[model samples]
Target: MMFNIELKDVGKSYGDNEVLRDIDFSVDKGSFTAIVGKSGCGKSTLLRVIAKLEETSKGTLTFSGEGSKDPKIRIMFQDDRLIPWKNILSNISIGAVNKAAAKESLQEVGLIDKEKDWPDQLSGGQKQRIALARALASNPDILLFDEPLGALDALTRMEMQNLIEELWQQQQFTSLLVTHDVTEAVTLANRVIVIDKGTIQLDEKIDLPRPRERDEKFTYYEKKILNQILGG
Candidate 1:
């Protein structure tokens, strides 16, 4: 498998606090990989390092394939992070509005009509949709999702999950999602990495096909992943 992102013996620290150590992983091009773990397990910190938002203290990071240097990487945070003063359309475009690209991206997230609306005018789910639209607008090669669905209600979360799965299939970007939801890991990821105590404890692939429904089979797989993360 050709990897778009590679981390070898990576480590990060804040003075005496070692947030991550000796991490190694590779993300295959266009694959959806999820990092799941308890809070304070350094999942977000690890993601920050991958996104280049933070520099690692040790080891090497490499990128291969198209336009590797800046590689069109976009990070979607838990908050929608939309500019309140800007209309949804402007917010999604974020100063780089190509009429065709912005419109198509917004439509993909089901916010085409809401483009003119203000950020405050939309529900939590709608706001998130706009955020995803913004991330997609960049035509990113890699998309880093930092608990982007953490704030939604159960029903909305499910809907957003479906929307994300659809978009991933359509866009085919290498995606790394840092989430605490085990069911979400099972539902959306091609592989799941369990991050614990500043390092990856388990890395398992999901052999299930795409468009996975939360059926009995999914539930069983979810339980197994939950156990692995919980160290059972």
Candidate 2:
């Protein structure tokens, strides 16, 4: 049940202020794409439109694939968004298949042992892992990440990145990630799209091999994206 996403000539606005203009973007099924841009550049808006959280002011957004129904989509945000009252297992199992399925999702994020802990009992990174598990428990066909690692410290962020990549490779779900981190984008995404000033500025393919290192080629893509975002 693979699904591909398409957005043709999409434009979004609020009143007189345009957030996205004449955007033409498409995401291939089972590929990881990262959207990068400076703050207020409408990168998140583009994702929201795809997620159908907000409607486009103009243009078409559609999904095409095996069935007539829409694809199953899930989003993981920067905030963990966990229930303080619910234990970790209950949190992931809230809308999940069952407790066993929720436990599997927790295990995938390396937090099965924390299933008994409260959200407040865990650290920031642990909370985010629970959030990821919750999103995964749904068995989404498309997983959207909105800077989920933004709040973690450097080492924990790297670990989370590795976990995400591992799970993504294993699950093979289509992923769209919105991040301000160029290095992270290069590390995780098959393609990187740069949104600038309410429009698509650059769409660059990351041709490097996986388990990516911050080597010369990696930095090259990073610098290129950073420059584009910085208006270089």
Clashes of each: 0, 0
Candidate 2 TM-score to native: 0.98
Candidate 2: which stretches are off by over 4 Å? Answer: none
lDDT: which candidate is best?
2
Where does the lowest 10-residue lDDT sum fall in candidate 2?
Answer: 64-73
Work out how many backbone clashes candidate 1 has.
Answer: 0
State every prediction's TM-score relative to the real structure. 0.95, 0.98
| Candidate 1: tens digits of C-alpha lDDT, residues 104-191 | 8998988799988999999999999989999888788889999999999999999999999999888788999999999898889989
